[model samples]
Target: MREKLQLIMKHLRQGSLQKMWKQTIWIYQYGRRYWKSMILYTLLGVMGSCVSLASSLISKDLVDIITGHQTGRLLSTFAAMIGFAIANLLVSQASGYASTFISLKVDSEIKNDIFAKMLVTDWESLTEYHTGDLVTRWSSDASNISSGILNWVPNLIIYTFRFISALAVVLYYDPTFALFALLGIPFSALMSRPLLRRMRNNNQKSAAMNAKMYGFNQEAFSNIQTIKAFDLIHFYTDRLKTLQKDYISMRLEFQRMSILTSVLMSIVGFIVSYSCYGWGIYRVWSNAISYGTMTMFLSLSGTLTSSVNSLTSLIPSAISLTISAGRLMDIVEMPQEDYSQDHAVKLFEKQHKTSGIGLTMKDLSYTYHSGTEVFAHASMEAYPHEIIALVGPSGEGKTTMLRLILSLLRAQSGEFQICAGSDHNQKLNMSPSTRKLFSYVPQGNTMFSGTIAENMRNVKPDATDEEIIEALKLSCAWDFVEKLPNGIQSVVKERGGGFSEGQAQRLSISRALLRKSPILLLDEATSALDVATERKVLKNIMQDTYPRTCIVTTHRPTVLNICTRVYAIRDKRCEVLNEVEIEKMVKEF
Candidate 1:
């Protein structure tokens, strides 16, 4: 026991106490919003405890009345007991129902707020966390915070009130009996310090294990087709078994420690109960108290002991809550995307709705957070009604250029903007807000589980069937789409299942075309299509009446002929391709 205290002092000296207090304060902020509901729940619990206390005292009076034949007060005492019992039962039920309602409400509201924050978080900053880890923190950690916020504070108040009141009753009846009831309190307090340190550590490990399993499952299910193709069914199953074994082993270790702690506490509780029992019977034999008094003493003694145990149990719960809050805080407090120029971008879109916007970059420079340079002093321009091509060997800056244009990544230095015309005075700087001015068709099968029409409408939710079909025809996807029984409404499974790669690419292009944005950036979006189809898609985009500026990055040479001009990314700069250079590139392709 002295060693535990020494360790606690050691922990305090190391400044862990301050860190723990900060985490506690962080969690308390969430609980502060639902003050009214928490107060109501606490009141109900206190009311139930008062009624229960009254019931015990009333029964004592009823017992004495029966034994002494006091017929005058018999009916009244009996009626009071029954009424208090029923009221206590009702309050308990009401409190339980309110708990569930408030818990779910708090959980959903916190999740909704945090989910929105996650979407607006800076893209580069957010990529530091894995998808699975983020989901776990957003879901499991958020739920823990809510449950703790709703229940922990109120339960602490309720249990403490019950304990103090019950102790008062027992002490007033006989102080010696109260001492016997408290025999377990000191021993229970001693056990808690060690258990708290272990509980907090175990919770962190458990949470990590859960996230690892969730991530593995999500990745496996996402690549189930590949797993089947490679005949890795048994290998994945064995891997899952290994993870399960590690999870089970971790849980069992914690459980064993918990079981041991409970056993020791229980033994102490038993000793205390018997001591109160022995002392009460002895007092009754000496005629110092009546049978009714002895019965009431036993009842209050049990209550006092239980309340002590309940109070001790809260420490572990508090520790767990603090850990959960810290995990969620790490994610929610990241740098959010800056939308300071959103209104400006919106105004630009409104003014140039018909004329369309032109992308302009001058002396542009960018380096990743890891210090890898993508573009340095690179400049490019794409005017409305022109198809511009970006060509480079693999590992070059082609895709990186598109990301910079989309403002998914920020440039370390230099200028990026969009304008209505040649006049630089009418230009707006690129930012998260500028994303609304452009439509992007990135590489890969980026389809969600939905129908063909639903996928197209993801970009323009109010798009009509006529608009969807027109966009599809431009990408040559309407030919296959029309063959389906449901046409545009036909179901498209996850990752564009039930369709060829080329067909999916065409459908993606169709969705992008439907957006009607002024600028269209295709980052290897047509790689899966045939040379003729790719050329046709580029031509269709270039000829659109909406004055769309198309920029495409590709390895193929066929689409270069249709481009107004081409740029090759080399040595961290965009090198303009002349007629000779363009012809040489086409021949090389």
Candidate 2:
């Protein structure tokens, strides 16, 4: 638990703006794509401020004219005040509309950039982050940052300028009164500092708890079947209750800090208000200031005091904003493997390529972070028009070896290459396009939530209806698909529900077949299917279809009958097996 906490803190610390600015800058550039809206917003802000200040000054003039008994001057000042009020309202409305427009544009652009980054990120790197945590960072965290930029930053700047301008006006009329009004500054700072710290700590905890709860719920719902089958519903419910209790505690802590800050601000406001009024009355009685002047000073006091109070209130929000900014920076700063360089070797167009797709692993070895080696000096080859079968005891690294060959996980030592075409001279390193030259069906047979046509399009977006039907037929999925209410347009719920395990496997096989890639990887893709269905799919790939290069990792000997070559993996070594030896091992099993 301490180790996990330390990891979370490490992420928080790295979320600094200094580390995050490059990505933020890129996002800002995209936001600036709508320069017209930003420009209009800025202009409206300035105009609104001018109109507001003008109204205050006009009110002061009206008071002076009434006191002097000048009817003409009083009427002129009143008219000017009315005119400024109307202008303020119009400018305020315009500013609000413009600000909203800019905010939405920035929000959309940032979300798009984060999604694009997620797509290119290494698969292993992505596994280190929880889906719930990532969702919060992408949605809630980004929203906080956008709010700070669009609303808080702009409002703070405007109010700050207004405060300074109001202060200057107050000083011009009475310097002593202005000094008394400024007393709220240090008092507010003293009260807000500790409250801001408490709020920030609690807010961070709350955010983490929310992420944990989301993850827990997602897991429980996704595995509802397993939970029901095992009679573990009460266990999961108790766990969720415990998480909710913690979340409530954190929220209460935040609210307590907020209440304390509000109480302190109220005290500060009372002190400043009484002092200003008492002093102004004394000055008026002594003839040191006129009634008009005293009235003006009193009016300005409220604006001045509220501005200071607003500043104090903004502190906690600013801290929250900083925390969110740091979170976003963490994801943006994670080291990304560069794929933009020209190191990519074009294997498809090369003349010395083997007759068909072939894969080779030369002295490949891999070790995980826990120092448990999955493979040691492992090597194997799969040629075109043939199926290579890997047989191993559980945990002997069959799945790990398949991942290495597919470049889903990088090898710690040695290399994985595609040596294919006429001369077997074409060597392909892992590149963006090279990685896509093969289709993989993982062990779990996971399927996304979408229509059958949509899932097929994920493999070959431009495939025609006829081509898709052909692939489904080859995988023995056409009969079931045809029986569905919507046929190919049928929607499969998340994880391919509303279908048997065997049916889902057939669909996955069809999806893989649609890729038309040179190499196909089946990591127990047919494990869930019965013997008959599995045999039908295997036979179709080996004899009846375009015989692409294929690798099948499994322990079932019945599944290996169609393979052109067989490898036995034991004690962290891969050894090629002759047909007689394979038959002997099969009989023993």
Candidate 3:
């Protein structure tokens, strides 16, 4: 007896019921916003369940009337049965519609919030999550949570009410049979106890595996060109097959566990049901109850048993929901970047009347989470009306420096100040509101599938054709663009298909130029261009009437010739170079 008690207590705490309830309450609060619909749907469902139970009870009266134990008017009895059936049908339909509508609404709102949060979260922090995992959490896990709110929760409530009503009715006729109904309760609870933890583990594992599969497929398809070039179709196919096999294995294991649990529950159900049958037979044989009461007892016994089984099944559903909720909260609870600070904007406006914005980094230090130092107390300055070049060997924190300037990453200890026209300087930071101060064109193809004009206007939606043409001219792209069939209206495929690398590079620059940000960051933006074209583009950018601060990262000696000053990043230090130093570096290159 002592061992049995200990085992039962262990099972009760296996699935972290406290955490499950917390997740349930969190979802409940989201659903509570549409409380009117939820309440109405639940009430309708309960009413529908009650009406069906009434119809079942009326069968006992019909049997009694037919047996002549109770005299009844046949027409009135049949009409009453038909009325309850119609009422049940109507209530069930209304409940279905209400639940369906509410489920969709909740799913939409939750997805929108998650996507918005993803965009506003800190970049360095957000990069920790895999894209596929984020997508799976928002799509599949979120949908399951919606279904739980709409289906599992309501069914549990309806079944609980039915169980109580049927049990009461059975007791009303035969207390002995009610005791049999009570026997099923403990068996149902026991079946659910060992299943909650297993189900939750299976659910979380399945979700992760699915995300892995998604990420694999996404990467494979996105790099199809490289795969074909390398003649690795068979290699990719075998890898995908391996992922699919693993996914199937997990699913089959979960299904097998489900089957085993169901079989055990069914055994408990059969025992309780047969015991009630035998007891009712003995009662009838002893002339203790009439045929009508015996029939009612048998019917109520099955109903009570089924309701108990249904309620127990909810435990697994709740476990699934809690697992999904935990996955979603992992993202929704991340720290969001604060974007509404007005100090940057206030200073920008105050200094704009005097001069252009300049960037100043003072005693900056940075290290990665893995303890790899990228920069150490590095300081630099870039002013408007001049070009600043960051020259370094690959992977020496040049790109990291640009990202830090863009507010994509933060330094451990440093003051990155933004110097406006006046001498008044303020710390530079990245926020939604302050991001507009700088335009960044990173290395690689950044074009989407759209018309050239549409791509250009993405940053300034209301830009006129005249403004677009001017920006393109400034990037030295207008010459090629005007020669195209539709010029600015020419459609470009994904990643600027049908255009050479140099053309695409120029078009990307044009889009950045359209933004007219006071500060422009070009990270190897002109790598594909020849020396002459790159020189022209760089000259136009610096000599433009806007007098903006331009920061360029490059390995080309010709590109560095036009810069006002150059900073070389080497040996964890950033140092300014004079003409002789630049000449020496150019000769080394």
Candidate 4:
């Protein structure tokens, strides 16, 4: 008791109570949305409990009629007993079905809402969490909240009503019997205080471990190719065994505590139950109450004990719900992506359609959260109908630069903007809403499991076969796609399986081309293509009538000859290279 008090005081000092209160309010908000359904469920449960109470009373009467051999009223009482039993069965099944359906609906809707929010969350903020961790919260934690909202609250109310109703019947028939049934309540309450504190801590550890295990499994499957290449299959299997042992150890520790508490509660319950049974027998021996009345008293006393047990069981469930809410709260409450500039971005696109858009960066500086500076005072430009190149060795922030331009990462201090014309006077600052103005193909096989045509239509969902073919041809992907047995309709397996890496890269480029944004960013997107084909793809972009501004990051100097301008990234800065400088760097390469 002292330890539990100390724990609570510590939490009060740390403001955990305030946090718990906020979580409760968050849960209530979800409950408020489905208040009508919850109210209906509660009514159904109360109706079921009432029917059960009536059945008990009818059974008492039938017992008395049979003992007395009273033929006059026996038939009617037995028939009434049978009808209540059937009614109880029907009500139980209907309510159970309704509860399941309602809970599932709640789960689906909550998942959809959380899934959308996570998609729009700030990319930089989301990078702090692993993919597996996010998924566990999205799936398991969200489910716990949904089930608790529909199940826990209704069960609490129904069980409380059952307890009170049962106690009332026992009191009406014989007040002394109620006292014997009440003997277990004090001991159960005393055991709960410490159990609750321990349960909360255990749940936190258990939830975190669940996330780690889930993340480990997801990553292993996703990187199976790498694992096989390195011949680390046995290593991975051994690691999985270690994690399973840890998980099982944690579950068993909690289970032992639960078992201990259950045994103690059971002891008290048994004592109270037997006392009630003995008192009823004593009354029957003394002829103070009839056998039927004694039987009724015994039944209601058992109901009282079971009902109390059910009500107390909800405490652990409530803790689980709060824990789940806190997990979800960490995710959904982070800074969301700001789309306030969307309307203005669309207007800019409409005005610049004919001339296309260009990019201008001046006096730009950026550093990562880890205090590693990517670049400082960087400056660059890409005019319409031009191909600009950023060349650098590894770890010089080529991909980081693309992320900055795409607004996936924020620069500490800089000017990155898009302009309607090459002169760069007319400009709008870059933001999440500006992402629609550019199409990007990062370094990877970005194809999902779908048809070749479906992959192309990801950027333009309503694209026709002719438009799809045109984009593929522009990216130089038409050669292989046209040769496929199903042509544009051929299926691509997961991670672009059944296709070479270069082919997947070409298809990704094709999807970007289909979007037809004014500006295109290709980060190492063409590294897989042969030099001749790579040069040909860039030429196709330049010859297109859209006046598109193309920016590419590459290590190859072969394509730099066709570029409008080249910028070398090194020494914590971006330096524009002249013809002499470009040639000198090509010789160095």
- Point to the candidate with the largest lDDT: 4
Taken over the whole model, the C-alpha lDDT of each candidate is 0.88, 0.77, 0.82, 0.90
Per-residue lDDT of candidate 3, residues 1-589 (tens digit): 7986887577567856567777888788766666676567678878987898888777778777887878988778878889998998888888778777887887788778767877888787778988888888889988887777777766878889988888788877778879976777887777676787687788889889989998888788878888999999999999999999999899899899879877887788788878877887888789887677878887788888888878878888888888888888778777777777567666674568347788788789999867899999898998888899999989998899998888787788977767764464544554446666888999988888999999999998999999999999988889899999999999988877878888898889999989888889999999999888999998998888885889999988776778998999977778998898888877877
Best by TM-score: 4
TM-score (all chains, Cα) for each model:
0.95, 0.88, 0.89, 0.96
Answer with 1 or 3, whichever has the higher lDDT: 1
lDDT of 2 at 98: 69
Ranking by lDDT: 4, 1, 3, 2
Question: What are the runs in model 3 whose C-alpha is more than 4 Å off?
Answer: 1-34, 150-153, 180-183, 270-299, 340-354, 422-433
Candidate 2 C-alpha lDDT tens digits along 1-589? 6975875577568774344455456445544555565556656765676677678777767876877733456667788888889889888887777688778877787678777777667766677889988888888888876666565545676668768877888899889889877878888777775676576677678778877888888889989999999999999999988988888887787777778767877887888888888998999889887677777777778778777877777877777776776676667666564565233444352433335667778777888766898888888888777888999888888898877776667778886777764546667765455655678988884778999999999978999989899999988999899988899999988899888888898899899999877788898888888777787888888875464888888777876666888989876778998878888877886
Give the per-residue lDDT digits (tens) of candidate 1, residues 1-589: 7986998799899877777898888887778899998998899888989999998888888887887833448998889988998998898899889888988999999999889989988888899988999999999999998988888888899999999998888878778788898898889888887888898899999999999999999999999999999999999999999999999999999999989998898888789878877888899888777677778888988888888888898998888888888888788788887889989888888888777788889999999889998888999998888899999998888998998998889898898999884353689989989998888999998776799999999999999999999999999999899999999999989999989999999999999999998899998999999998888888887777878989999988777977998999999999889988888878887
- Clashing residue pairs, backbone N/CA/C < 3 A, model 2: 15-326, 353-420, 353-421, 353-422, 354-420, 354-421, 354-422, 355-421
- Those runs of model 2 whose alpha carbons end farther than 4 Å from true positions after fitting are 1-43, 63-70, 73-76, 151-156, 283-295, 312-318, 341-355, 431-433, 544-547
TM-score, cand. 2 vs. native: 0.88
Distance from true location, Cα of 457 in model 3, Å: 3.3
Worst 10 residues of 1 by lDDT: 64-73
Tell me model 3's lDDT, rounded to 2 decimals. 0.82
- What alpha-carbon RMSD in Å does predicted model 3 have with respect to the real structure? 3.2
Model 4, residue 178: what's the lDDT? 88
